[model samples]
Target: MTEIFVKSLPLKDVISNLAEAFDTVYFNRCQEYQINIPEKYGTGFIRGINFDNGFGLLEYSCSFKESLSIHFSVNNIHPLKFIYCSEGTVKHRFEETNKLQTIDQFQNVIVASTSKNGHILLFPRNQKIQLNSLEISRKDFKKKIDCDLNHVNVNLRKLFRDLNARSLFFYHGNYSIGMSNCIDSLKVNGLDGFTRRLFLEGKSNEILSIQIEDFEDDQKEEPKRRILRKADMIQIQKAASLLKQELHAPLTIKDLAKKVGTNPTKLQEGFRFTFGLTVNNYLNKIRLDYARDQLMLGELNISEISGNIGISNKSYFSRLFKAAYNINPKDFSKKIKRNSSQQH
Candidate 1:
């Protein structure tokens, strides 16, 4: 396996430093950046969006073939960040305590506080990692809001206040179901230039807004959150992937749990804790999304689409599709055809 050597860069202005790390990094007319690292080690792109204000975003959808290890330190108050792992995993360990936190797929947080000390990020080989690092300078972030900080969500306000001190604070939770869908909608595979920048920045702010709402909801949770063993967490995630693979099959939750090597109770609670949706709700979401795409493609009628996705009741399928997308399946397909003809 070939290992890529990385030079140390500044952490305070993380986005700009990211711009410098790549051999093919450039800023577009919009001041957004496109970063392409050496291909021998990994393949894919990193997109960065910088606003006139200090708000910024760095989105990574790259996979490495060899392990990556880096040591870095930030002396200044680090940018307040909202980190989400939409795919793969990322681990962070501070040097002083060596305590670590791992963010798994579909998990998110408005970063835990960090000491001014150094930390290391490890990226294992063969894992396709997709991450969104949204951040703002502590000073700029504080200025962006006009209202009294104290009146904001206690958890959010507390996170900001932690920036002023030498201590670190950490909160790990899942984003709202709406936010998770938004995350899935971020398409970066073949995008370029202004369109890519527009989507990244717009969606970044939208996710940030929902993150604030998440923080408020975080305060309402009971003091105790169910803790799962690392092995159990892995099994739960395996179950989720299985669900996606067998999305059209009419497998009950019991079968799902058994296949993933966990009990029904753990499966339900784990789904709720990790993905912010129950098993049935999550399954329906993916199925409906698939049906909607099939409808847009004009490949199948409502009945075929519904049956293909394992919904035996045609009325119920239409109701579910309409409730989720606000458009009847038939009309959605009609609109797709009409637009295609108009373009022609």
Candidate 2:
């Protein structure tokens, strides 16, 4: 196992310290600091950006050649962290605790060590892990957003107000789909320079809000109305698989819900929550994506392609295809043919 110990404050120094450990240098652009894993170590990258508001983001998307553990032992108050495991498993524990927590896919943990206590993160070798850490310096964050914590949940409000790190805090929950989407947006956005920084800051604030809300919902006495729980996520995945398997003969929302052992409303809610699309729209997307592939093959007419995907109306299919791809099916097919002939 490879172990890297860090005792740095603020984020830039942390990234620099990590880079030094990896035998590589970190680059900074528009306040974003990033480092690629040295070839001798593994593959992929670790990047982070800190905002002026004391909230910062650190992302790890890498596969190490060997097991690794990073120990953060800053001798002062550490930042509160909202860590999400988007892809592989990650094990975490407080520096002073024996109990270890494993964060699996789609799971998140909110952690804050007691004053001067530290945190340890373990990454298994050969696993392509994608993790994000949202860090907040409680003292700085409180100064920026210091207001009546009346609207915040009692526990979280207290956590936010613990600027001195008077108590340790840890909570684990499945992150909301909204938070997932927001994080994705942060990674894939095209903005650059000052604009990118502003966009990231805005999204960071949005994500923090979502985290607080998810924690509050998880704390609810009766969570029957929670549509994004682990059980619901499983049902949603089942529903999606069903949709894809029966794309040519899509089921009604009620029938699909029945197959998934959920009500139509909850099923729809699940779809919206997990996929950001209603059932019908998601089905349409499936159909359209399939149609685009068939069109690219240049073997089937637009009507046949549409029919094969369960769209009966030729004109309606054309409209949906146009709306989705910004070009009519016929034109898309012709363009494909033209390109094929030109290559020949």
Candidate 3:
């Protein structure tokens, strides 16, 4: 909510002392949120109870010439942190009490707590370093993706590192300005509150998608080969049609599969193969498309649209509709109305 900027402050003695002083004051106000950065060692720490309001604030201390250790701790309850490193290589120690590990220069690190403690250490290359922390919650996270987390972690790190490396190389080779300019853009163009929350949610899903793509690329598992037979496809189609007709009703995959004279697994496989999307995906697409059509008629608001579509959660319904249509439901409806007026 509040942005504080400090420029060219003394890093070694003064800045560290200031950080220590601030930590003492911050901890006293709210026992739930605690921060400690010792004056002797070039390190910092932050802890928060809930990520609802967002992560606790911190004062970054770094010398333009010295390499500083920026220590961060997120309790197990807090969601993953998407960190964008602006300058220098950051070695990250994933969970609490783990060996010191490093995420090389120009990379984004996703830190999640497996148990109750998660931590990260940033080793700055230059005194002038910039970074943005986007806090994400597990509840708002969606992983419709079908890959194991352990399998995806390594691949994700590699993919991000590769992307950052390529981007940096291109910028340095072709652009007039250097890496500093790029870092400035990244830090300054940081998202506003709503967008930052959305970005965090999107990034989590993006990570999962990357893992799914990795699996698809490796050819270790093939969906086409495991697709259902013609008979099973027919059953799935029938079930899908029935579900489509009853779009205003609450339908479960299990019940739908049973109604089609098949089990859930076979139905899911067949539906996915036949439609090129998961059963839930197909169902949502149908619902949203129907909602769009109704909105074009200019007869209902979002709440009514959600209710008529058998989705009780209006916010979730809006999110789903936006995800499907590439525009928010309200905006899509407004555009439709504007187009109608133009036609008239």
Candidate 4:
């Protein structure tokens, strides 16, 4: 494995140090710096930008020809980092320790080294990898915020106030959908100059907010369940769209799970997380909602509406509709017709 040592503070200088190690030049525009990996070592580039608020963003989209480790060995207190892996896998550990933690695709880690211990990031050889690191200098961030820390969560408050880097902190988990969307937006919209800087700054803050919220949610005392990855969320969304489009052919949980590339248990958990309902309950709600709209159109009778939504038993469908909307399907349809007649 090859190793590159980066001994710099702030983001711009970090890019410069990396460029020196890679034996390549770097580009700078509007305080953002970018450097491409030399052909001998790898392909792709690493971009970084530092905001006036002490927040910085470092994006890595590259692959190395051999296993590589970038060691951050700054002499002063290092910035707290929220590192996210969007593709492939990366390993991380404090420079002072041998234990390493692997961050896979769709996963993230919050890391702060004690004092100047620094951090080391390892990338496997010949694998496409994409990662984003949100770096925050606590001292600068505190001054920028210019607010009391009493309102913050206990763990986070301590983290924010530890400007001297008195203790170490680390957390790992699957990134939430909000964070996934924020990360995706960073790669879109061809904005440049001040507009691009402002856009990135805004997104940086948004991603921080989401990270804090997700950390808090993870701390809650909930039942043990599988953590949902971004891929799982996408599958869950596909299942929902399928359910809506095929209202006349409702699928069983196992079938729906198979179609969506997830198991029944994960499907149920994802539905509950995304929609606050189980899979069957969500499907039922969708069917009833669709039936309500059809009834309002006055083009289908109760029996036809029930059949259209894959409910063979009209009486059972009526019970479900009444439970959901507090009115029997027949009565709701009659009310719609009566209101139409009155209008005419």
TM-score of each: 0.58, 0.73, 0.34, 0.74
Per-residue lDDT tens digits for candidate 2, residues 1-344, read: 99998753577888898999998999998989889999899999988889886889888999999999999888799999999888999999998799999999889999999989999999999999999998898888887777768898999988998989889899988887778888788779999889988998899889888888888887865324353554467888999998888877899997998888767767888888778999999999988988999888878887788778888899999999999999999888899999999999
* lDDT per residue (tens digit) for residues 298-334 in model 3: 8888888888879989889888988888898889988
Clashing pairs in 1: 112-170, 113-169
Candidate 1 Cα outliers beyond 4 Å, as residue runs: 1-29, 70-72, 112-115, 148-151, 162-165, 188-199, 222-344
- Ordered by lDDT, highest first, the candidates read 4, 2, 1, 3
**Predicted candidate 4 versus true structure: per-residue lDDT over 80-100, tens digit per residue:** 999999999999999778889
lDDT for model 4: 0.88
lDDT of each: 0.69, 0.87, 0.50, 0.88
Error of 3 at 227 (Å): 6.6
Per-residue lDDT value at 307 in model 4: 88
Tell me the deviation in Å of residue 249 in model 1.
22
**Structure candidate 2, residue pairs in collision:** none
User: In candidate 4, which residue pairs clash?
Assistant: none
Q: Model 2, poorest ten-residue lDDT window?
A: 222-231
- Per residue, candidate 1 scores C-alpha lDDT tens digits across 162-192 of 6464666567776555677677777633566
Q: Quote model 2's TM-score.
A: 0.73
The ten-residue window of minimal lDDT in model 4 covers 220-229
Task: Using TM-score, give the best candidate's number.
Answer: 4
Q: Give the Cα RMSD of candidate 1.
A: 11.4
Q: Point to the candidate with the largest lDDT.
A: 4
